[model samples]
Target: MPTLESFFAPQDNIALENEAAEQEAHLIAEVEETFMKLIEIREAKFMDMMDAREKKYRALLN
Candidate 1:
């Protein structure tokens, strides 16, 4: 005895939407964290390069 109303469960839509929103938020947080890590890596690399360059200049002066 399947009625037309049984084909669609409207009550489940809210839960589904909430779950999707939670997943999206989690993904966004992960992306932000990854981006911060990349920035930190880039900054550290730049600092290392600058230090190396400064040492080279100091060696040339002496």
Candidate 2:
């Protein structure tokens, strides 16, 4: 049995390596998408904060 397994081991290893590479690439893409969404949310919040501050300053001046 061991001898039979050894004979097929190289093919099995190649298949596993390909699967791992595919999974890694998928995970990296997901992480990048999530990061971009977070950045967009942050920029929106910052813009809102600046607008509110500008309104407050105008009210003070008036």
TM-scores of the candidates in the order shown: 0.84, 0.83
Clashes of 2: 0
- Compare the candidates by TM-score and give the number of the best one: 1
Show the colliding residue pairs in model 1: none
Model 1, residue 22: C-alpha shift (Å) = 0.2
The digit string of per-residue lDDT tens for model 2 on 20-56 reads: 9999999999999999999999999999999999999
lDDT tens digits, residues 1-62, model 1?
Answer: 99865676887777777899999999999999999999999999999999999999999999
Give the alpha-carbon lDDT of every model: 0.92, 0.93
Each prediction's RMSD over C-alphas, in Å, is 3.9, 3.4
| Candidate 2's TM-score | 0.83
